[model samples]
Target chain A: MTERTATIASRVGLHARPAAIFAEAAADLPVEVTIARLGEPAEDALDAASILALMGLGAAQGDVVVLRAEGDGADAALESLVRILETDHDA
Target chain B: MHTYSGVGVTPGRVVGPVRVMPPAIAAPPAGEQREGTTTAEAAAGNLRSAAAVVKEELRGRAAKATGDGKAVLEATALMAADPMLLKSAVKLIDAGASAQRAIWEAGDGVAAMLLDLGGYMAERSHDVLDVRARIVAQLRGVPAPGIPDADAPFILVADDLAPADTATLDPAKVLALVTAGGGPQSHTAIIARNLGLPAVVAAAGVGELADGDEIFVDGGRGVVTTDPGDAEREAASRWAEQVSRLAGFDGVGRLADGHRIPLLANVGGAKDAVAAAAANAEGVGLLRTEFCFLGHDTEPGHDEQVAAYKGVFDAFPGKKVVVRTLDAGADKPLPFLTDATEPNPALGVRGFRTDGTSPGVLARQLAAIADAAGQSRADVWVMAPMIATADEAASFAALCTAAGLQTPGVMVEVPSAALTARHILDHAEFASLGTNDLTQYTMAADRQLGPLAALNDPWQPGVLALVQATVEGSRAQARHTGGPGRAPKPVGVCGESAADPALAVVLAGLGVTTLSMSARAIPAVSAVLRSVTAETAGSLARLAVSAPSAAEARSRVRARLPVLDELGL
Candidate 1:
């Protein structure tokens, strides 16, 4: 399994349009991607592909969140998603 | 011919075949469909087939949709075919439930979870519900529930229309709208008026009407007739044509005796401002500043505020623009500014009262308005909302002056402000009446409550007395300065009351110097104003004030203005 931490860059946080795009990206990956608050247990985290779960995080801009992925191509998938999380969709 | 009577919110006449929109689906039974249908294999197969069919339909719609609508449709499609959702449904199916019941239970679970999460997730609950309905319909081998495609223009009848449904409707294909539910102030009514479509709301037996039934709707008279005779159709057509011709007369509003009552438009945002300008509104009466602040997590900065205000101000150069400051309360809570919880937001800290806690927001907004005014040649006037005391009025005036904004005024939305209008006007430059809120506050009835709609009527004698008091207050102030009593300091009606032609006449008679309303309503109101002299309008106003109830006041005023009936108002 690979883990990554990134700050939410969207002005409106990980919700609305940005949340939709992020969830779709995770669903397209070959690995199982999960997301949770930084330093929290993975058991309490949610499937990264669930749009409602990602939006429920209430991760505002500049807030830190953790992402985890397992199985083949997990590392590559996590990096790509991290890049998306750090980019401002509003811009 | 069978007939039904309803409140016509927008006036026009049309005849067309009826198109009934299917109401929302009720929750399916939460158990197995039959005694022997408990096989997991059968349930899994059913779930897959149902999801696939719903997904394909959504994808087809997504392909045809464009712009923002495309994204929403595509998202719904993705949600319908979600692998997790399919797995969840299969789990229920394996637990001794039929395929339809399993799918229903799974969808309900997700919808409840989303709603429980609240905030942004809660908003998505509707999407889940809609997708579930589509899948359930597919499993049941029934047509999906929603609006149907129309090959031609038709009169749409529905229980009620959600904003999402209305956004996707093709206005050109809709002749008129009649609903079994909703009120005159409902979203359906507002959208119909904006689109120039005739609409009647709260029509009884509308749900009983069948598809393709020929019907005649006289929106002005709130009358709907089934299979109308030729004479009735011809009369309606003639009346509609006359009203259309009257709309084409875009001259300044005036009575037969040439009493000038500047006709303005109440614009909510920049787009409405453009439409109002196109309608040849002499100026803008109520430029609501709420759009700049609402829907934002944080207060908009000075630059953002400047750009927004400038967009509207630049549209109406050298035209009068009266803007009301931010009016937020429990009804419209902004977490960054207003308190998160309030027992009653309407009576809580809102409008000008917000200045106490969020002083920076008010100061920044005033500064931005001053900047916009400096850049544009429009005659900008600023006002504070919900001001009940002379001290608050004076303080608001001082703030505007400090920001270099002249012509500061107050809105008479509160009953106390209306009662002490002379004292309030003494400090402010002018005043505008917001009859909607004034009626709500005076009647002690929430405008949002449908059953209390009668009490919310502006025609109520009690409400009229408040309006009369405001006008008289302004006059007393004018007389106190030893100035002529005629045309005192520009008291205007910039509310829904000003939109009704008959009510507009009565308001004019009550010493209101200007009238402002939605741009589409300006033409009808202008037509009515041209027929009534100032003296006749005053008499109508007097009669309305003395009437016991709103219904009686309306009849009395209508009797005094017989030409209103002739014009189909």
Candidate 2:
């Protein structure tokens, strides 16, 4: 299992176009990834690939979230997701 | 014949059969039962296939759309095919929930979650609800939510139209619009005016007009009548014909003595530029930049802003396009830029005032405008709204010049701005009076308040006095700025006031160099301008400002321009 924490860079947070972009990136990964608020329990996490769930996380701009991936290339997937999360889609 | 009265937001008349839009879909009962194994499997199979079908339909529509419309349709398609939603529905179906009810409940759950998130997320509630209704309608074998298709031209009667529904309306098929609800500022009225469709909004019991029932809608009089007399029918047709003629007029707006008053359109986005061009507007007088900012989680980047700006500027090559910078605050509180709540948002930070708290936003927008201006053929002019002092105008003008925008101006919406227009225009190049806000601010009446709508009238002598002051001040500033052989600094009227043909003449008489309104209003205003000389307009302006009240002022002007009654002004 590999996990990484990143702050939401999108001015509007992890929602709308930003959430869609992040979800699309997660969906393209070979490993199944889950995301949750940084301090929340893993059970509260949502499938990173699901746009609605990702949006329902209510992660606003500047919020910190943790992403965990477990599978082949899990480390690479976590790295890629972290990079996408840090990028401001609104900008 | 029964008749109902409301406010006429859009002008003209039409007689046609009524077509009332169906009400929204109701949520399915939660206690629905699915049959045993085989039946449950069949229902699940149906739900799966129906999702795919709706997704495909959305894809087809998405392909046909452009810009933001294309993005929205594509996103809606994604929501329809969401794997998470499918799995949830299947589980509910296995738990004795019918397939239709399961889909409705699952979709509604997600929509509720989004709505709970609020702000931008809550705005998506409508889209989610729309997709849910579509899938449920498919499973139940019923019509989808929204306007129904008609075989012929008819009057569209609805409780009120959502922005999405109004976007898809076909003016050729919908001869008129009568709504049981919606104030003058509602989306329905705005769309009706933009489309040049005759509309009577807030008409009580408009929904009672049965489908295929012949009705006559007098948009100017705000009356919907059934069984009109011969004279009324003839007059309605004549009025329609006159409006068409006015709409078809391709000439530049001018007075009887050939004093040119460049009639322009006030557009919210690039899509409206096409309509303004079709209406033969000399140019865009007020291009609102809020469309680029609205619904976004954050401020749009330079590239996106430039693309949006260039779209409108390119549409009117060699024509003037006056763009107002992002005027967000108060009524349009941007979460990222303003406080969540204010005791008096109307009097609080708004318009150009956002510069204090959100510095880079305005600068980025100005930079984008400058970049877009470099790429387009249109003459782009930028302005700041709600500027009250010459110092602010000077600073704004300085920043605009530094950013390579030479023609910077300020909106005379604030009473102080109007009172000191001479000094403000000395720093800025021109002034455009936004009478809606000016009247609202002058009369201390909230524009959104229906009960005070009468008090918000632009024809109020107090508002007219402010307008006259701005125009005279602008003329003085223009002379001071020009050493010799230079035209005076142009002061224009770009508000609902400009849409009133009688007031357009009065505005011109007050030395307003231009008139900008909805594209549909251009023709009647142009026709009125042709009948009145600049000198006559000046006298009317005098009579209007001297009156004690808005009603008295309106009547005084009307008494002088008897031709207005003939033109259905």
The candidate that wins on lDDT is: 2
Cα distance off (Å), candidate 1, residue B155: 1.7
List the candidates' TM-scores in order.
0.89, 0.77
DockQ of each: 0.37, 0.34
lDDT tens digits, residue span B88-127, model 1: 8888777777777777787788878776766445556678
lDDT of 1 at B331: 53
Error of 2 at B227 (Å): 2.6
Residue B245 Cα positional deviation in candidate 2, in Å, after optimal superposition: 2.2
Q: Residue A71 CA error for candidate 1 (Å)?
A: 3.9
List model 2 lDDT by residue over B1-569, tens digit each. 98999777777777778888877778887688786655778888999888888888777877867777777777777778676777788999888798888988888888888867766776676677788788887887776667777778888998887678765687879988888876565567768877888888777777677878888888876789987778668877798677656656574999999999999999988889987887688999999999999766578889999999999998899999999999887667665676645788888888898898788888889999999999999999999999999999998998898899999999999999999998998898889999878988998987665446467678889999999899878777767777556666889988878988888888999889999999878888888888999899999999999999877888889788877778776
TM-score of chain B of each: 0.88, 0.80
Distance (Å) between predicted and true CA of B53, model 2?
10
